[model samples]
Target: MARPEPEGRVRRFSTAERMVHRATGYLMLLCLASAACLYFGPLAQLVGRRHLMVTVHEWSGISLPLPSLLGLFSPAFRADLRRLNRFAVYDRQWLRAVRRRRKSPEARPAGKFNAGQKLYAGWIAGAVLVMMFTGLLMWFMGLLPFISRTSAIFVHDVLAWATTFVVLGHMRKALEDPEARLGMRTGYVNRSWAQRYHSRWLREEHVGDLSERRTVE
Candidate 1:
């Protein structure tokens, strides 16, 4: 579903993918904001609704992955997931370049997701699962006495802060890559963007498009 558009644009994210992304972002924000109100003393009093905030936090956390889960029903979404999961030799090169903080793009054979994006995706997925598990434990502490409520709180708080900083860093990078943001907004990116950071991907897309055209002919 992600292909070249008319003019000099290429599709980056499909509309469904963008919708899933936006929904998940909103849910995550709701979870964070509600959690802050429930957890912080001043915020809790200022909000004057501990019970409501707690309910919102619990339900929002539970629903955080709902959009992504529903998106898997789309075959296009599944294929995009495959691309994200398939790391290549060039991914390793890119990781090295990132560790060194190379001043320029390393001319690595990047795919739809660069190695950094893939790694971040993997991390966030794991973090979400952990948070969910710990949150459920804390929500129903009496159900599982074997699990330490204190430990769950500690892990949840730590991961919440970790997720916050990681997301902030991601946002900062997104600010630098305005085209990437546009791709998510409108499901399309400039063709030159593909050539610049993902030349290998651009070449592969061209070949695939050409083959498809021939097949159509």
Candidate 2:
């Protein structure tokens, strides 16, 4: 069970959602930090534990999907996954508005996830899968005699850099929206924030009855 939203706020993320995000984010940070130590010669020397760093990096990347997999057991997480999968008419309108560099949350309303978010989610999901695959291949070159370890390493390195940049960009974007960060952190967001950026989602919520909702259950 959960407490009521604050008067001016509404439930945006469920507890399960926040837990999964936090778990995945922490694991990702671990992987990136270990990778930085492993990949950079100076850092590797400074860290001075090559074998330990390799072990940490390998295991962290391998565990990256576990939080998301476990989250599937949560009804709230499953519901949000469905939301992330669907793309409606308003999603297209949102993308168009984004390309034109204008804010039209009302006319080009967005649901729980806008087009850009959906794309980013899809891309990061795919990238993680690819990274896992390539990383495994690199770790066990003997497992695939036909596949070149060099090629696997190349792809892994490229994707790692791309993921780093994309993650940095994501963080920068999140910093621009304090309400969004608050929603993810505390499971509630100001009603006005939802109305401005996720008007469609706000409309779908029972705004008047938020006090009756159990946001953390």
* TM-score against truth, every candidate: 0.93, 0.91
Local distance difference test values of all predictions, in order: 0.86, 0.89
**What tens digits encode model 2's per-residue C-alpha lDDT throughout 7-36?**
999898888899999999899899999999
Candidate 2 lDDT score at position 175: 99
Clashes of each: 0, 0
Model 1 stretches astray by more than 4 angstroms: 1-4
Superposed on all Cα atoms, model 1 deviates from the true structure by an RMSD in Å of: 1.9
Residue 189 lDDT in candidate 1:
85
Task: Specify the highest-lDDT model's number.
Answer: 2
Instruction: List pairs with backbone clashes in candidate 2.
Output: none
Candidate 2's C-alpha runs over 4 A off are 207-217
| Predicted structure 1: lDDT | 0.86
lDDT of 1 at 46: 92
